[model samples]
Target: MATDSEKLGIKIERNPPESKLTQFGVRKWPNRWGCPPSKFPWTYDTKEICYLLEGKVKVTPDGSSESVEIGAGDLVEFPKGMSCTWDVSVGVDKHYNMG
Candidate 1:
């Protein structure tokens, strides 16, 4: 596999038979699998727009213990300085934007 830094800005499409792809701090996708993965809190230095293309995730904020499950076609936004832990369950395919 080639590094994204070594390639042009491209989009990875998740279609039938092919699933699960991650692009650095750009985007990730998991198809049909249960319980995607647990990840570290993201306190983005840049604004992040997360749109749930499928499945559910438990998003727990830092400093505060509040969490929520956002699923299919849902939208979530986090500005700079916001930190949170992401517990993705029942798989997920989402588009991400960070710069």
Candidate 2:
């Protein structure tokens, strides 16, 4: 089963089957992002869902020490207004779009 956790408005769903995600229209996201290992900061103005196709990342929300690790086959949601830093430890490729 997929596991989901929410804190400070971010949500992560681990290891969700691709079929189930497709059924929910996950593939409809218009953008595909690919990045080499790096660290960057971001802020979301609208909710965003990311479906990882490869590699991994750790997202640390601004002002919080806690972080969420995401990788291939994972589904992650960043809520509106959240500020965070992404540490792409293994680089990554994913489909993402605003919700």
Candidate 3:
């Protein structure tokens, strides 16, 4: 069965290989850090690919009841123009690129 993330058009790969990270040059991407117990709305102006180094979060797309859970060791992609609310339960540290 398709996961909630798939249904929401949010892609997530858990604990991907190092080669894949290297292929995407994930280490070179700019980093983003967020503290826990916060909620904020965000809209993606461009597609974003990120690799989470630490922390956990739940992102609920606008107009949806479900939230997609993401955490450390995950590689995730958020589509361009997607509007969502980020609920950060744990502090986050990640590398991200937008295009």
Q: What is the TM-score of each candidate against the true structure?
A: 0.56, 0.89, 0.89
TM-score of 1: 0.56
**Model 3 TM-score on a 0 to 1 scale:** 0.89
* Model 3 Cα lDDT, one tens digit per residue, 12-53: 888888888899999877667556678999999999998888
Ranking by lDDT: 3, 2, 1
- Residues 1-99 of candidate 2 have per-residue lDDT tens digits of 888887667777888877878876878878999999999999998889888999888888999988878889888888899999999989799988886
- Cα-lDDT of candidate 3: 0.86
Task: Write one digit per residue (lDDT tens) for candidate 1, span 10-87.
Answer: 122223121232323224522223346666566678766555568777777676556765666544556666677878
- In terms of lDDT, the poorest run of 10 residues in model 3 is 1-10
Best by TM-score: 3
Candidate 1: clashing residue pairs, number: 1
Model 3 / residue 99 / CA error / Å: 0.4
Greater TM-score among 1 and 3 belongs to 3
| Local accuracy by lDDT, each model | 0.52, 0.86, 0.86
